[model samples]
Target: MKENIHPDYQPVVFMDSTTGFKFLSGSTKKTQETVEWEDGNTYPLIRVEISSDSHPFYTGRQKFTQADGRVDRFNKKYGLADENAEK
Candidate 1:
């Protein structure tokens, strides 16, 4: 509860470099850049490499390989499918 001991926590604008997505949030990090927000006010601007707007996981762009299909392919490659069927 000491005064003047905590860093400034203020509204800042974070912009995604790839997707050009911008959001306003409170952050203690300081930046020299400023951007005017929709509220007609300027805030510190921070550029980020990736954000939820452009992330593969969030954007549903991630590739998911089916394990069952892979196993079937491997079995066919080594002719194991026929051996299992005979057993």
Candidate 2:
């Protein structure tokens, strides 16, 4: 370990912009804004656009689209019969 060679790893608060969720964690990221947490401590506030709170995958709101390729799209667009539909 070298002296003054590592970033200052300290407690950080990540705020989800959409869900307004905040959690405390450790990081070396710097921030100019901060808010007092429930524990009566002020930590670095890092506003994030997406987090587990508002993420579609985490919130069970994600949509799964099956890709059938361009051929399937062309067939469906012009009402062309699908060869696979015969089976």
For model 2, residues 1-87, the per-residue Cα lDDT tens digits are 889999999999999998899999999999899889999999889999999999998899988776888888888899999776865
lDDT at 24 for candidate 1?
97
Measured with C-alpha atoms, the lDDT of residue 1 in candidate 1 is 96
Q: What is each predicted model's overall lDDT from 0 to 1? A: 0.92, 0.91
Query: Which runs in model 2 stand beyond 4 Å of their true positions?
Result: 64-87
lDDT of 1 by residue, 20-51 (tens): 99999999998899999999999999999999
Instruction: For each candidate, give its TM-score against the true structure.
Output: 0.70, 0.71
Highest TM-score, which number?
Answer: 2
lDDT of 2 at 42: 91
